[model samples]
Target: MGKLTGFIDYKRENKEERDPAQRIQDWQEYDAPFSDEVLSRQGARCMDCGTPFCQMGEEIHGATSGCPIYNLIPEWNDLVYKGQWKEALNRLMKTNNFPEFTGRVCPAPCEGSCTVAINDPAVTIKSIERTIIDKGFENGWITPRVPKERTGKTVAIIGSGPAGLAAADQLNQAGHTVTVYERDDRAGGLLTYGIPNMKLEKDVVERRIRLLEQEGIDFILNTEVGKDISAEELKHTYDAVLLCTGAQKQRDLVIEGREADGVHFAMDYLKGSTKKLLGSEVDGEQSIDAEGKDVIVIGGGDTGADCIATALRQNCKSIVQFGKHPKLPLVRTEANMWPQYPNVFSIEYAHKEATAKFGEDPRQYSIQTKRFVKDEQGNLKELHTVEMEKVQDENGQMAYREIPGTEKVWPAQLVFIAIGFEGPEQEVLDSFGVETFNQKADAKYGKFETSEANVFAAGDARRGQSLIVWAINEGRELAHKVDEHLMGSTVLPSYLEV
Candidate 1:
């Protein structure tokens, strides 16, 4: 707990984001760091409400609340308030393996569930967390701690995303020889390519990868499991295997003019952009060119927001994003209460930059794309859309209804579909020969074991597309399960179980 009545005395303040106009010019991070004094004040905002839900890390009515990794938020907040940076870092690292990643990209569900948020603004937990970890690294408190002894057990983790990396870190620390296989040249999968650098700098991801490598985790990059290396081969080689390839099979728009030259998947567009920015070979993939072109991104989610930001960085002439759902209320509605991640309206970094430059928000809510229009040469020219309204059906179930006479067309030279992913790559899943249903790996929830012996799955592969925090949670849980299988009841931490 922080100072008594600190939530009442000190107002909630977050680290300021760099100017939208300036930040749009480069791929560097836009968030400014909070000083120690400011971090302490923000930490003081954590109320000493006997039952601290900020660390509950549970779901209510299918909505996430608090820190998924079960971070000891209050303890660290109190430590930060008392200027105990080292102790705060220790407590923070006990649950979270990569606060830097979560600090930047996590939606901070913990803040939404904070007791103070029920009345006043929530504590700046994300900022305080980032400060604790960053300061630890700055002061040389974070160093590689290679395992003292080897368990003679080997684990092969597929993918280098949050889930794979977290599992690898935990297993390697448990004295298990861990080798991570990544299809990309770099180790961080989503962190390196899926997410744009402005929101989360590649350097931050690379720093953590370096630390993991120093901690004795082997990384075999540019090697696809189903292609470069066979699944059977890996299962026979490693004592255990964990699949964390993620739900990467992107959903497609199957409307008219589907094969327009300019229409592209949002993930491919982002991957190509990051590859070009990092001077990596695109391998003949079509790269995005939004300069002087009108860009339209379908699907109003974080991926869509990233597309808007990426297009802005390329100086797109105009940008608009479409969402099927209605605009969220300015404040929490009756159905959307305090504990769940607030389903309320909040401007993202890209929205700010777009508004600053375009004079209005780039989002169009309650809209549905009818089809894509094409030009003479088969390139994208325009997009047909219609407005949608909420209406109850005969059974009293809420559904979307298209409003007639509201059909419209918008000029679009480039179209990016950010409709999200479907599931893991079918080829990889088939190669593993694991049971699957509804596009998810069929594995035991608590143990993460697949049908095949010594084989397991976790994260997006097991569950569908989910949050990075959830991915980390699954990875840690899988590590515990694999360790238990190998050593007959292990000591790995499974926070979700707690």
Candidate 2:
């Protein structure tokens, strides 16, 4: 530990964001940079508990808690507190290959499970982590590390998302020749296209890609497996093939007038917005402008919240959110007490911006979208919805039941279905003869081994849609398994220590 009494003497601090009114005018990052001294103080708040639940990738109340990659949180926190930034960076990179991405986008489950959070506020773990990495980059501490020798074994990985990148990083460290194939014009998968640039800047992703290129990892852009190249061809040419394709199939809304012109999937909207911000200059053609439209986003998840924020940037006239579940309590209830990731209310940055502008919370809980009402031009005009009550279905599964008297229509020019993803896009999987473990598709997970003997899978493709941290963890773990399958043994580190 850096200081014996650091936890008691120091208080937690977070990096402040820019003024909402000013930030909404542009698509740039809004977080104000904090000084090194303030970040060091935040790091010192780590209590360094004996059991250190922060580093333990535990499952509480059926939800994964703590760091999924098993990040050495306390160790790095101490290193940062002691002003040994280089060492802190090294310790952090030991488990997580991309702290820069997770430090920005992760919900910080570690903070939720922090020992200090039982009564007081949790240590500013995410802010401290971001600072350590940003400082590392500014100080020229991060550099490419090319492998000493080549193992003469080549691997082909599909998808350039976090999982695919993590797998490639690990296999390359073991001296294997790794090549990643991406369908998009650029690499980084969702990190590049799906997520809005305000949350994770495109330049941040480009910098890391540059380093990976310098380290000799081959990235093939605009090359899709099932379309341009055959999956069988990839399997024949490489010693091993790892499928890291993420789940991209959007869970759809089946309702009246669903095929209207003004309705779109959340991914389509997010992808278009990011492309526009990155100078694709196609927003005018593909972008749905909320400038003079009343927008109602269906589903109140991260993606939905992002849609709201993006709409605000476009100067939307009005906005409201629909959440199927009841509002969460301010604190954990008896059912979600301790160690578990509490299902509680959180005003995310996007929600905060919307509320500030709209003069009320933009979300409506326990509400379900029933249908889309379209104008004479076949454009979506309004959302017909009703309040819902949860009840058991015929299969003994919990499902939403619409309340009879709560039916109402809200004006909406643009409707975004942000329900969630179903599973991996099945085109490549079916063509490759890979069986998915998930029922939604034909591919199988867990063994990760596909229908073919040498084919393996990981990330959202195999495990279904999840957080960036979990995807990285799955990628790192699968690399070890694939390495052993190819070479009979390996030296790549496993993120899951247990």
Candidate 3:
């Protein structure tokens, strides 16, 4: 530890964010980095514990506890505290392929599992991490690490999301000629489009893509593997084919009025907004303009929050987000203990903005959507919802029951369903002829092998939708597995080491 008593001496401080009312007017990132002095003081708050659970990366009771990619938190914290920014960046890059992405979008499960959190406020880990990488870029300390020699073998990776990008970066570094295929006009599957610009700016993604190109990785955009090039052709052309295609199958609200003109899936709405912002051609059917329309978002997750923020940017007349589950407790319950990601209530950026703009939080918990009502013009006009009560079934499992006579209708011209993804899309999986079980690619985690030989799957495609950190873990592991399969030996480091 940099300072043994530093944890006791310092109180936690987070990054400063733009005023909610003012920030909602633009698309820029809301949070601002701390000064080096403040960041150093924050870094010094890392306590000298016998064991640091901040990097454990375990899943207890299905909630992510720590850094899934096993980031060396304590080491980097000490480096930053000692004014060793370059050393901190080096340690950070050793584990995470893209610290900039995780530093911004990651939920920071690492903080939830911080040992210091058991008593006092946890260290400002996320803020310090973002500063370290942002400094690395500002000082030109990070650059292309072009491989000196080629392995004379080629690999083709499908999809260019976090997992695919991570795998491509690792394999390219291992001296193998790697090519990444993306169906979109631009790369970055989730980071570029799935997320709004206010959260993760597109330029940040572009810079990394540019860096990867300088390092000798090829990117082919606007090309779907199955439609443009057959899977068999890809299988024969490359020594190994890896499917890092993400889980993008959106779950729809199957009810009456689902086909209403203004009703849409969250991804479609978000993608349309982002594409329109980027000046990409968007068709009439794809354009889900929320301007001046009363909007209702169904789902109680980060995606729903993003939808709320996006609608606010679009200048919607009114906004409301519905959640099937009740609001979480203010503090951790007995079921959720230390080192387990805290299951508590915290206001997200969207909630704060909504409160600032609209006098209320705009979230309605324990609400179940009954149906969407359509106006005479066949456009979505209203949403009917019923209050729900939590109960335990005969099997002692938790379930929700709708209350009678509690149905209420709210004016809603636009509806976005952000109920999360079921799993990876089936079209790509079918093209590759890989076996699937329960909507996931039938592939082992450590080995990352799919049903077919000379092919592998990882990330959200292999194991349903998850965090970017897990995607990085699987991507790096899959890269190692592919290298082993191709050359029968690999020296690429994976997430196994702490």
In order of appearance, the predictions have TM-scores of 0.98, 0.95, 0.98
Reference-based lDDT, residue 494, model 1: 78
Instruction: Report the number of backbone clashes for model 2.
Output: 8
lDDT tens digits, residues 429-451, model 3?
89888877342333333857778
lDDT of each: 0.90, 0.84, 0.90
- Give the alpha carbon lDDT tens digit for every residue of 1-498 in model 1: 999889999999877889998889989988899888998898887888898898888777777798889999999999999999999999999999999999889989999999999999899998888889999989999999999999999999999999999999999999999999999989899999999999888988999999999999999999998789999999899999898999999999999998988999999999999999999989544477799999999999999999999999999999999999999999999998988889999999999999988999999999999999898999999999999999999999999999999999999999999998988888887898987734232333475877888888889888888889889988888899899999998879877467
Off by over 4 Å in 2: 281-286, 391-399, 439-446
What C-alpha RMSD separates each model from the true structure?
1.5, 2.5, 1.5
Q: Model 3 Cα displacement at 437 (Å)?
A: 3.9
TM-score of predicted structure 1 = 0.98
Residues 1-498 of candidate 2: C-alpha lDDT, one tens digit per residue = 546677788777767998877788888877877777886777788885888777777666567688888888888988888888999998888888888898888888888888877877787888778877887899999989999999999999999999999999999989999999998878999998887888888999999999998998999988988889998899899999998999999999988899998888988888888877777755443576778889888888999999998999999999898998999999889888767776899888888788788888899999978788888989888878889999999999999888899999898888888999989888888878976556313322336677787888888888788889888988898898888888898787665445
Worst 10 residues of 1 by lDDT: 436-445
Q: Cα deviation of 254 in candidate 2 (Å)?
A: 0.5
